[model samples]
Target: MISTWRRRVAARRAAKKKSIEEDDNANMELTIPNHFRCPISLDLMKDPVTLSTGITYDRESIEKWIEAGNVTCPITKKILRSIEPIPNHAIRQIIQDWCVENRSYGVERIPTPRVPISSHEVKEVLTKIEDAIRRNDDESCLDFVSMIKSLSKESDRNKRCVVSNGAGRVLSAAFDALSKRDPIHEHVALHEEILSMLMISLSSPLDEETRTNLSTSESLHYIVRFLRFGSLSSRRNAVLALKVILSCNDQEVVEDLVKREGLLDALMKLIEEPICPTTTKASLLAMYYILKSSQSNPDKQATISKFLEMGLVQNLLEILVDSERSVCEKALGVLDGICSHREGRNKVSENVLTVPLMVKKMLRVSDLATELSVSILWKLGKDEENGEGTVAIEALQVGAFQKLLLLLQVGCSGTTKEKVTDLLKILNVHRQSVECIDSLDFKNLKRPF
Candidate 1:
């Protein structure tokens, strides 16, 4: 019995020692070898590649460096004879073996990296797509566009490469051709795939030529078609792409775009029944830009009238009642722009919820929201027709009087303070007519105090 007990004690000690050794190994393994890390990122190099300067880096890190217009090596600062980096396969193998050896320490092995698509290759794909588009081969166009979309999704480098290689021109031309030859129902898949590629191309930094190519009236018309009739995914991409394209173009282009039939209705539809928050915000921004661009046009009020006729006032009020801060601010901005015209102000003042909602959002949402709400109220209050203090009466009824006082107390910007003061004077005129609900006892309160 004594011998058996001694043997058991020895076994326990041996097991404990083995665990201690493993703990020590894990601690030591935590310190990665200096040579295994990329010089630029200081992280483990999963796919090491050597520059012409003999300095090695992870493929992604070095590629980004080169793409950023850097012709010199990151570490050595020597001018690169060739920007092309040769794969450091031997170092990658060493790293993989190290990871395997340290598997017990929870080290994960990095898989071999795929070679990035070259500019020449992207150009080749574009050539094929252009050929297919010219031949009116729908199947070939779909296949090649799908291929480009796949490559674009792989990495940002590939996306830049695709765009730099005239992907936008190619895709826009395809859209133009598709619109001319194919009815909307004939090639649904092909149209959607082309839209998908256009969306990807638009995401990259667009050069002047590409922007001009994309912002054409014909292209805008097709995008509007997709925005109205395409699938849910296509609609989302369409609106987002529209926002980018509009932002890049000048006011004349935007003026023409807003005049497109069914454009306003399509945007309002997106706002009313948002597919996603992003699409809703994009729709609002697009409308905002349109209103802004039309300011210098001869028919600015006519444009505002167009929006008011589309029930924009009601939609913006609904958005203000409940939305995130960003969406609320944008909706308020559009409403403010609308109120720049008499028709817009009258439309806004007619809605009972408009004044109340604006007052509620004043101190609650954000400073920008507060500013826009105040601006809209000031426009309504100061209107010659509403100058009879009707707007002030409505505002005072909805507690705008107290909110304006609070805004003054808290302090505000010079411009905001001016608006607030003017609003205070306006609301003050009707303050006497406003009944104090808190002070009145319903049973004892008399009518028309």
Candidate 2:
């Protein structure tokens, strides 16, 4: 009987130990220390940083708060003396230890954060660059620009800091100064570096003053020079910078930019030789904006004639054949703009793959692409009837009628539906000539003949 009583007591002790273990496990799963969590995010701080107000928060959350134009601390409700947040190393270490200990519970340790560049530091670098440019010290100028470029590439915060601190003005000044030096070929490396720095610094949107400063004729002349003669990377940066400058939408600036001799040719070469997809896209966008701006100018036809003479239509048709969706869309957009003119229409109609390629791209790509393709076709066949024109005949031969019928059945925008209806009417005139349309079930088509 005593042994039985002892056994019962032992069993009670074992059960109590198991209960304690289960409670510990549950606690591990449910609890995170309140001190480890950010006041702003209410989540565990990955890069805990202390503000001037002595309150700690995650780096990203607090940076966003400061960037949103807030000057006061969220928790302390006091105005911040400084915007910089000091890293809370001790708390970060504690969090790391906790994460390591609770790793089996799916916790991962945060990486050590890279310190962001301060606006003061960016200004200091700009000062050095200005001084170097003043002294005409090519070596020092290259070093300083390279340093700024490295800092700009470090993080988005650094790029913003560089741009916000008037880097564009300083860099453009340097570029203008260096480009005027005697024996210009000697400073090619410096020019490339400055152009690269300018490209990186201006990656973000600019304020009015900075945009105006960059929009000058002197600045644009240097960029066009580089676009024609600089190395691959330099050429890329030059064109990208040109795009940003043109983005200001200044009419006088756009007119001056397009009239620059060899500018359109340089862009065409970039498209033809194809440095990289990004550079090609930038070139296309630059051309698109130039063409778009010309619509209001008296020199609109003159500009279109220049592009047509450069064989832009053929180049764009080749791009349409197999380019990626976004690229194909852009190429088609440019083509559509060009085709709006009579000469542009003749150039497109002359290309054999124009109709078939346009038809293939209609339903296979995105909605915007479909709209563009349909618009280009409508421009081509809208004037042609009874399959008399090459566009209509080729489109009929390539099953374009069936494609348009299918596009209408699947539904499209109001504009697209109207264009499709017009195209179907044009193609239906030749439907009796083509054998393919006889098999298509037009019974489901909502558009009447």
Candidate 3:
């Protein structure tokens, strides 16, 4: 019995060795057919697993193998994997059948998907808002805005179209009705109550006709006032609405805005405020519009200079120093424009824009701030007044050269470094930046500085 057991173990070892040889030979001989696919995923198999009738693979695993198309069944060599919903060979036939089923001359077929909203439901909401308007109820108006906001949350496209179409048309009619009923209460002066509602209404993307009609209403004064100055909650809405109106590029609106009593003053005041960087940025944009429309007279220059004189360059530089990359980029762009425009450039030359101080501030901030700091430096370098070239190269302070070289090393890629190298060369050529490069390591620098 012991001899027979030993013989059985030896036979089993020999059988396993034979099987390994067969697998090695099989690996070399196997070839995949181009047309075959995995039956489960209908995709070309990769490292395909052969399954017995009882062995089942999970859907996710099968899908993964289908993505790698070389897998195959151990027993049957087949490639049955695909991403196409139907096989390419049968697609033409399937399309032909579908068209035949839907085809009929002059027939109007129903849509595959339908959305339902009753006219009564829309009328009900409009009536509620109208009643609220008639009673001069803030709570009712708030409720109406809430309902529209909720519907917008569900289906953005449908709700936007419906709200803009239905709410806008009805609101216009309601204003007309209010005027007809009580002319005294209607077309009232700017107040917080109506301003809040109009702010929300205009916030929606109004149709062109609705926008024009609403603009024509005397009630628009509330909107204009809110835009100039309002609670933080209402201010952004007002600003955006003003932007839309400005986008129409109406010379008359631009003229009237510049003529408005507090528009310029309010924007100038906001720019000097330390907090609300976002609001300040928006105000800057508005100021640009006002400047574009107003005469480039001494008054306009003084107003802008006052902000810069109030040390706006420092405030704007601080924002540029520690802002998100995109925000810093935009702020730098605005600074460049403000300093380089005809009026702005003259202001800089007068030392009101203060190139030396701006360069010092940039030097105070490290080079790691953002890549665009390089751009800011480059722009400042363009201001070649009294031989500044962007910054006054001839009169650069003792430590300015070191600061710029340090900035060139940080956040700059290949092209940016090349430009920096070129800029350094130009400065050296003028004999203003010779000692700046002498203190740095340049073992790997491809181009001469």
RMSD of each: 6.2, 6.1, 15.5
Summarize candidate 2's per-residue lDDT along 153-206 as a digit string, tens digits: 998988988988989889887887776678877988998898888887775466
In model 1, where do residues sit more than 4 Å from their true spots? 1-13, 26-29, 63-69, 182-187, 203-208, 215-217, 248-260, 297-306, 384-386, 393-417, 428-449
lDDT for model 3, please: 0.49
Give the clashing residue pairs of candidate 2, or none.
Answer: none
Q: Please give the lDDT score at residue 21 for candidate 1.
A: 95
lDDT string for model 1 (1-449, tens) is 99999999999999999999988987783778999999989999998999899988999899888988999998888999998688899999999999998888898999988777887889899899989988878898899999989989998877888887788888877776776663556876887788788888875446676666667776677788889888899898889878887776487678778778888888989988899999999999888888778766656676787788889889999888889999999999899888776677778889988877887788778789889899988888888434578778877776777778777777678899999999888777777767332212123422332
Lowest summed lDDT across 10 adjacent residues in model 1 is found at 437-446
The 10-residue segment of model 3 with minimum total lDDT is 105-114
Per-residue accuracy of model 3 over 24-135 as CA lDDT, tens digit each: 7655643323333445655433223323322233233453554466455322544445321212323223333444454432223222222323345556777787778678
lDDT of 2 at 190: 91
What C-alpha root-mean-square deviation, in Å, does candidate 3 show against the real structure? 15.5
Best by TM-score: 1
TM for every model, in the order presented, reads: 0.83, 0.80, 0.48
Regions more than 4 Å wrong, model 3: 1-146, 153-207, 210-220, 227-229, 269-281, 292-312, 340-343, 346-390, 394-449
